[model samples]
Target: MNRAVAHPQQDGQDRPGPTTRLSVNIGEATAQVLQKHKARGISITETVRRACAVYDLIESEAAKGSKIQIVDRDGTTRELLLIP
Candidate 1:
Protein backbone atom coordinates (compact mmCIF):
# COMPACT_ATOMS: atom_id res chain seq x y z
CA MET A 1 0.00 0.00 0.00
CA ASN A 2 1.23 3.49 -0.80
CA ARG A 3 1.65 5.76 2.18
CA ALA A 4 2.12 9.52 2.54
CA VAL A 5 5.22 10.31 4.56
CA ALA A 6 5.89 13.73 5.99
CA HIS A 7 8.75 15.74 4.60
CA PRO A 8 11.67 16.51 6.85
CA GLN A 9 11.76 20.07 8.16
CA GLN A 10 14.41 22.28 6.67
CA ASP A 11 15.95 25.64 7.63
CA GLY A 12 13.82 25.56 10.81
CA GLN A 13 10.73 26.26 8.74
CA ASP A 14 7.60 24.16 8.54
CA ARG A 15 6.83 23.17 4.98
CA PRO A 16 3.88 21.51 3.36
CA GLY A 17 3.44 17.88 4.37
CA PRO A 18 4.55 15.18 2.00
CA THR A 19 1.84 13.53 -0.05
CA THR A 20 1.46 10.41 -2.12
CA ARG A 21 1.30 10.88 -5.86
CA LEU A 22 -2.10 10.40 -7.43
CA SER A 23 -2.85 10.16 -11.12
CA VAL A 24 -6.11 11.63 -12.33
CA ASN A 25 -7.51 12.45 -15.70
CA ILE A 26 -8.86 15.97 -15.62
CA GLY A 27 -10.12 16.82 -19.12
CA GLU A 28 -8.85 19.73 -21.18
CA ALA A 29 -11.01 22.47 -19.70
CA THR A 30 -10.32 21.32 -16.16
CA ALA A 31 -6.65 21.05 -17.00
CA GLN A 32 -6.72 24.68 -18.13
CA VAL A 33 -8.38 25.70 -14.87
CA LEU A 34 -5.77 23.81 -12.91
CA GLN A 35 -3.01 25.50 -14.84
CA LYS A 36 -4.64 28.89 -14.28
CA HIS A 37 -4.71 28.26 -10.55
CA LYS A 38 -1.08 27.19 -10.65
CA ALA A 39 -0.21 30.36 -12.57
CA ARG A 40 -1.80 32.33 -9.76
CA GLY A 41 0.86 30.96 -7.33
CA ILE A 42 -1.00 27.85 -6.26
CA SER A 43 0.82 24.58 -6.61
CA ILE A 44 -0.77 21.89 -8.79
CA THR A 45 -1.13 19.64 -5.78
CA GLU A 46 -2.79 22.44 -3.84
CA THR A 47 -5.16 23.17 -6.71
CA VAL A 48 -6.20 19.53 -6.77
CA ARG A 49 -6.48 19.49 -3.00
CA ARG A 50 -8.84 22.46 -3.02
CA ALA A 51 -10.93 20.93 -5.78
CA CYS A 52 -11.22 17.68 -3.81
CA ALA A 53 -12.19 19.65 -0.70
CA VAL A 54 -14.98 21.36 -2.60
CA TYR A 55 -16.31 18.02 -3.81
CA ASP A 56 -16.14 16.62 -0.28
CA LEU A 57 -18.07 19.58 1.08
CA ILE A 58 -20.69 19.22 -1.61
CA GLU A 59 -21.14 15.55 -0.90
CA SER A 60 -21.34 16.18 2.83
CA GLU A 61 -24.04 18.81 2.34
CA ALA A 62 -26.00 16.62 -0.05
CA ALA A 63 -25.86 13.72 2.36
CA LYS A 64 -27.34 16.03 5.00
CA GLY A 65 -30.47 16.49 2.82
CA SER A 66 -29.36 19.75 1.29
CA LYS A 67 -30.35 20.39 -2.29
CA ILE A 68 -27.36 21.30 -4.43
CA GLN A 69 -28.14 23.76 -7.18
CA ILE A 70 -26.31 25.94 -9.61
CA VAL A 71 -28.02 29.27 -10.12
CA ASP A 72 -27.33 31.66 -12.95
CA ARG A 73 -27.75 35.41 -12.90
CA ASP A 74 -30.83 34.98 -15.08
CA GLY A 75 -32.52 32.99 -12.29
CA THR A 76 -32.11 29.60 -13.87
CA THR A 77 -31.38 26.88 -11.34
CA ARG A 78 -30.18 23.36 -12.07
CA GLU A 79 -29.77 20.60 -9.54
CA LEU A 80 -26.28 19.20 -9.24
CA LEU A 81 -25.81 15.47 -8.76
CA LEU A 82 -23.03 13.67 -6.99
CA ILE A 83 -22.56 10.07 -8.08
CA PRO A 84 -20.62 7.72 -5.93
Candidate 2:
Protein backbone atom coordinates (compact mmCIF):
# COMPACT_ATOMS: atom_id res chain seq x y z
CA MET A 1 0.00 0.00 0.00
CA ASN A 2 2.87 2.33 0.72
CA ARG A 3 6.48 2.40 -0.47
CA ALA A 4 9.30 4.87 -1.00
CA VAL A 5 10.51 5.28 -4.58
CA ALA A 6 12.51 7.70 -6.64
CA HIS A 7 11.04 9.84 -9.36
CA PRO A 8 11.12 8.35 -12.85
CA GLN A 9 13.63 9.66 -15.36
CA GLN A 10 11.08 9.54 -18.20
CA ASP A 11 9.03 12.10 -16.26
CA GLY A 12 11.24 14.94 -17.56
CA GLN A 13 14.23 14.31 -15.31
CA ASP A 14 17.03 15.54 -17.54
CA ARG A 15 19.56 15.48 -14.72
CA PRO A 16 19.67 13.37 -11.59
CA GLY A 17 18.71 15.97 -9.05
CA PRO A 18 17.92 15.44 -5.41
CA THR A 19 16.11 12.17 -4.94
CA THR A 20 12.90 12.89 -3.08
CA ARG A 21 10.71 10.09 -1.92
CA LEU A 22 6.97 10.12 -1.43
CA SER A 23 4.88 7.33 0.01
CA VAL A 24 1.12 6.97 -0.44
CA ASN A 25 -1.45 4.43 0.60
CA ILE A 26 -4.32 3.92 -1.83
CA GLY A 27 -7.08 1.64 -0.63
CA GLU A 28 -9.55 -0.18 -2.89
CA ALA A 29 -12.17 2.59 -2.83
CA THR A 30 -9.57 5.32 -3.17
CA ALA A 31 -7.99 3.43 -6.04
CA GLN A 32 -11.39 3.39 -7.75
CA VAL A 33 -11.58 7.15 -7.43
CA LEU A 34 -8.05 7.45 -8.84
CA GLN A 35 -9.11 5.28 -11.75
CA LYS A 36 -12.05 7.59 -12.38
CA HIS A 37 -9.70 10.53 -12.48
CA LYS A 38 -7.46 8.62 -14.89
CA ALA A 39 -10.52 8.01 -17.06
CA ARG A 40 -10.73 11.79 -17.36
CA GLY A 41 -7.09 11.80 -18.64
CA ILE A 42 -5.53 12.85 -15.35
CA SER A 43 -2.39 11.21 -14.00
CA ILE A 44 -2.58 9.30 -10.73
CA THR A 45 0.07 11.47 -9.12
CA GLU A 46 -1.66 14.68 -10.14
CA THR A 47 -5.01 13.43 -8.89
CA VAL A 48 -3.63 12.42 -5.50
CA ARG A 49 -1.64 15.62 -5.11
CA ARG A 50 -4.66 17.73 -5.96
CA ALA A 51 -6.75 15.83 -3.47
CA CYS A 52 -4.09 16.35 -0.79
CA ALA A 53 -3.96 20.08 -1.57
CA VAL A 54 -7.73 20.34 -1.21
CA TYR A 55 -7.57 18.49 2.09
CA ASP A 56 -4.88 20.86 3.30
CA LEU A 57 -7.11 23.82 2.42
CA ILE A 58 -10.04 22.31 4.26
CA GLU A 59 -7.85 21.58 7.31
CA SER A 60 -6.58 25.13 7.31
CA GLU A 61 -10.12 26.48 7.19
CA ALA A 62 -11.29 24.09 9.88
CA ALA A 63 -8.48 25.22 12.17
CA LYS A 64 -9.90 28.72 11.78
CA GLY A 65 -13.32 27.56 13.07
CA SER A 66 -14.77 26.79 9.68
CA LYS A 67 -17.11 23.92 8.90
CA ILE A 68 -17.12 21.91 5.72
CA GLN A 69 -20.42 22.66 3.97
CA ILE A 70 -21.81 19.85 1.90
CA VAL A 71 -24.84 20.13 -0.37
CA ASP A 72 -26.45 16.86 -1.30
CA ARG A 73 -28.16 15.98 -4.58
CA ASP A 74 -31.54 16.46 -2.84
CA GLY A 75 -30.52 20.01 -1.84
CA THR A 76 -29.93 18.97 1.74
CA THR A 77 -27.04 20.66 3.50
CA ARG A 78 -24.61 19.16 5.99
CA GLU A 79 -21.73 20.62 7.91
CA LEU A 80 -18.64 18.73 9.05
CA LEU A 81 -16.22 19.97 11.65
CA LEU A 82 -12.85 18.21 11.74
CA ILE A 83 -10.99 18.31 15.02
CA PRO A 84 -7.31 17.69 15.21
Candidate 3:
Protein backbone atom coordinates (compact mmCIF):
# COMPACT_ATOMS: atom_id res chain seq x y z
CA MET A 1 0.00 0.00 0.00
CA ASN A 2 1.07 3.55 -0.74
CA ARG A 3 0.85 6.19 1.94
CA ALA A 4 1.64 9.87 2.35
CA VAL A 5 1.89 12.00 5.47
CA ALA A 6 0.54 15.53 5.12
CA HIS A 7 0.70 18.54 7.36
CA PRO A 8 -2.37 20.73 7.49
CA GLN A 9 -1.72 24.29 6.43
CA GLN A 10 -3.76 27.46 6.86
CA ASP A 11 -3.03 31.10 6.12
CA GLY A 12 0.53 30.27 5.06
CA GLN A 13 1.18 28.51 8.35
CA ASP A 14 1.45 24.78 9.13
CA ARG A 15 -0.93 23.30 11.67
CA PRO A 16 0.02 21.10 14.61
CA GLY A 17 -0.87 17.57 13.50
CA PRO A 18 -0.14 15.39 10.53
CA THR A 19 -2.86 13.95 8.32
CA THR A 20 -2.90 11.00 5.96
CA ARG A 21 -3.14 11.49 2.24
CA LEU A 22 -5.27 8.79 0.63
CA SER A 23 -5.41 7.74 -3.00
CA VAL A 24 -8.42 5.80 -4.22
CA ASN A 25 -9.54 4.30 -7.53
CA ILE A 26 -13.28 4.69 -8.02
CA GLY A 27 -15.66 3.38 -10.68
CA GLU A 28 -17.32 5.53 -13.37
CA ALA A 29 -20.68 5.58 -11.59
CA THR A 30 -19.07 6.82 -8.39
CA ALA A 31 -17.22 9.48 -10.34
CA GLN A 32 -20.51 10.70 -11.86
CA VAL A 33 -22.08 10.98 -8.44
CA LEU A 34 -19.10 13.01 -7.19
CA GLN A 35 -19.44 15.27 -10.21
CA LYS A 36 -23.07 15.93 -9.39
CA HIS A 37 -22.11 16.86 -5.86
CA LYS A 38 -19.40 19.13 -7.22
CA ALA A 39 -21.98 20.93 -9.37
CA ARG A 40 -24.01 21.52 -6.20
CA GLY A 41 -21.02 23.38 -4.67
CA ILE A 42 -19.92 20.53 -2.44
CA SER A 43 -16.31 19.53 -2.36
CA ILE A 44 -15.29 15.90 -2.64
CA THR A 45 -13.61 16.03 0.77
CA GLU A 46 -16.75 17.38 2.45
CA THR A 47 -18.91 14.78 0.75
CA VAL A 48 -16.69 11.94 1.90
CA ARG A 49 -16.61 13.33 5.45
CA ARG A 50 -20.39 13.51 5.60
CA ALA A 51 -20.81 10.05 4.13
CA CYS A 52 -18.40 8.60 6.68
CA ALA A 53 -20.25 10.21 9.56
CA VAL A 54 -23.57 8.78 8.34
CA TYR A 55 -22.14 5.31 7.81
CA ASP A 56 -20.62 5.38 11.27
CA LEU A 57 -23.96 6.28 12.81
CA ILE A 58 -25.75 3.47 10.96
CA GLU A 59 -23.20 0.89 11.97
CA SER A 60 -23.29 1.98 15.59
CA GLU A 61 -27.08 1.76 15.70
CA ALA A 62 -27.13 -1.59 13.92
CA ALA A 63 -24.76 -3.01 16.50
CA LYS A 64 -27.32 -2.15 19.18
CA GLY A 65 -30.01 -4.31 17.50
CA SER A 66 -31.77 -1.31 15.99
CA LYS A 67 -33.65 -1.45 12.72
CA ILE A 68 -33.21 1.27 10.14
CA GLN A 69 -36.35 2.28 8.27
CA ILE A 70 -37.63 4.84 5.86
CA VAL A 71 -41.08 6.39 5.91
CA ASP A 72 -42.74 7.64 2.77
CA ARG A 73 -45.06 10.62 2.40
CA ASP A 74 -47.99 8.24 1.84
CA GLY A 75 -47.59 6.71 5.32
CA THR A 76 -45.68 3.73 3.92
CA THR A 77 -42.73 2.42 5.86
CA ARG A 78 -39.90 0.14 4.70
CA GLU A 79 -37.04 -1.44 6.59
CA LEU A 80 -33.49 -1.07 5.37
CA LEU A 81 -31.25 -4.07 5.85
CA LEU A 82 -27.49 -4.15 5.95
CA ILE A 83 -25.62 -7.42 5.70
CA PRO A 84 -22.32 -7.79 7.42
Candidate 4:
Protein backbone atom coordinates (compact mmCIF):
# COMPACT_ATOMS: atom_id res chain seq x y z
CA MET A 1 0.00 0.00 0.00
CA ASN A 2 1.05 3.59 -0.66
CA ARG A 3 -0.02 6.85 0.97
CA ALA A 4 0.86 10.50 0.55
CA VAL A 5 0.19 13.46 2.83
CA ALA A 6 0.68 17.11 1.92
CA HIS A 7 2.20 19.39 4.56
CA PRO A 8 1.75 23.13 4.64
CA GLN A 9 4.40 25.66 5.51
CA GLN A 10 4.75 26.33 9.23
CA ASP A 11 7.48 28.93 9.71
CA GLY A 12 5.85 31.52 7.42
CA GLN A 13 8.73 31.32 5.02
CA ASP A 14 8.32 31.80 1.30
CA ARG A 15 9.25 28.57 -0.46
CA PRO A 16 8.79 26.75 -3.72
CA GLY A 17 5.96 24.38 -2.96
CA PRO A 18 4.31 22.16 -0.43
CA THR A 19 6.01 18.99 0.80
CA THR A 20 4.41 15.61 0.48
CA ARG A 21 5.11 12.76 2.86
CA LEU A 22 5.01 9.29 1.40
CA SER A 23 4.51 5.91 2.99
CA VAL A 24 5.08 2.58 1.31
CA ASN A 25 4.98 -1.10 2.08
CA ILE A 26 7.85 -3.35 1.08
CA GLY A 27 8.74 -7.04 1.20
CA GLU A 28 11.22 -8.63 3.58
CA ALA A 29 14.11 -8.44 1.11
CA THR A 30 13.57 -4.72 0.60
CA ALA A 31 13.23 -4.22 4.36
CA GLN A 32 16.57 -5.95 4.85
CA VAL A 33 18.15 -3.64 2.31
CA LEU A 34 16.73 -0.64 4.17
CA GLN A 35 18.16 -2.02 7.39
CA LYS A 36 21.59 -2.26 5.77
CA HIS A 37 21.34 1.32 4.66
CA LYS A 38 20.25 2.35 8.14
CA ALA A 39 23.29 0.57 9.58
CA ARG A 40 25.38 2.73 7.26
CA GLY A 41 23.76 5.85 8.80
CA ILE A 42 21.53 6.53 5.82
CA SER A 43 17.91 7.30 6.49
CA ILE A 44 15.22 5.39 4.62
CA THR A 45 13.88 8.59 3.05
CA GLU A 46 17.29 9.51 1.65
CA THR A 47 17.75 6.02 0.25
CA VAL A 48 14.39 6.10 -1.51
CA ARG A 49 15.02 9.60 -2.87
CA ARG A 50 18.43 8.61 -4.24
CA ALA A 51 17.02 5.44 -5.72
CA CYS A 52 14.33 7.42 -7.51
CA ALA A 53 16.88 9.84 -8.95
CA VAL A 54 19.09 6.97 -10.17
CA TYR A 55 16.16 5.13 -11.67
CA ASP A 56 15.08 8.27 -13.49
CA LEU A 57 18.57 8.75 -14.94
CA ILE A 58 18.80 5.11 -16.02
CA GLU A 59 15.40 5.21 -17.63
CA SER A 60 16.24 8.41 -19.48
CA GLU A 61 19.54 7.05 -20.73
CA ALA A 62 18.06 3.70 -21.72
CA ALA A 63 15.40 5.51 -23.72
CA LYS A 64 18.26 7.13 -25.66
CA GLY A 65 19.73 3.70 -26.49
CA SER A 66 22.50 4.08 -23.94
CA LYS A 67 24.05 1.01 -22.33
CA ILE A 68 25.00 0.94 -18.65
CA GLN A 69 28.26 -0.79 -17.71
CA ILE A 70 30.41 -1.65 -14.74
CA VAL A 71 34.23 -1.63 -14.80
CA ASP A 72 36.17 -3.79 -12.39
CA ARG A 73 39.56 -3.17 -10.80
CA ASP A 74 41.09 -5.66 -13.29
CA GLY A 75 39.91 -3.42 -16.20
CA THR A 76 37.10 -5.80 -17.02
CA THR A 77 33.86 -4.27 -18.28
CA ARG A 78 30.36 -5.72 -18.22
CA GLU A 79 27.00 -4.37 -19.35
CA LEU A 80 24.27 -3.84 -16.78
CA LEU A 81 20.70 -4.34 -17.90
CA LEU A 82 18.17 -2.88 -15.50
CA ILE A 83 15.41 -2.19 -17.96
CA PRO A 84 13.80 -4.88 -20.16
Q: Which candidate's TM-score is highest?
A: 3
lDDT of 4 by residue, 1-84 (tens): 232223333343225677568788899999999989989987776677667756776677778887777679998999978747
Give the clash count for each candidate.
Answer: 0, 0, 0, 0
Worst 10 residues of 3 by lDDT: 4-13
**Candidate 2 residues 4-49, lDDT tens each?**
2333334533256864557878689989999999999878776765
Off by over 4 Å in 2: 1-19
lDDT of candidate 3 over 1-84, digit per residue (tens): 332222333232233576566689999999998889989987777666566656776787779898777779998999978889
Kindly list the per-residue Cα lDDT of model 1 for residues 53-72, writing each as its tens digit: 57767787888888778779
TM-score of each: 0.59, 0.64, 0.75, 0.73
C-alpha-based local distance difference test score of model 2: 0.69
In lDDT terms, how accurate is model 4?
0.70
Stretches > 4 Å off in candidate 3: 1-16
Q: Whose lDDT is higher: candidate 2's or candidate 4's?
A: 4
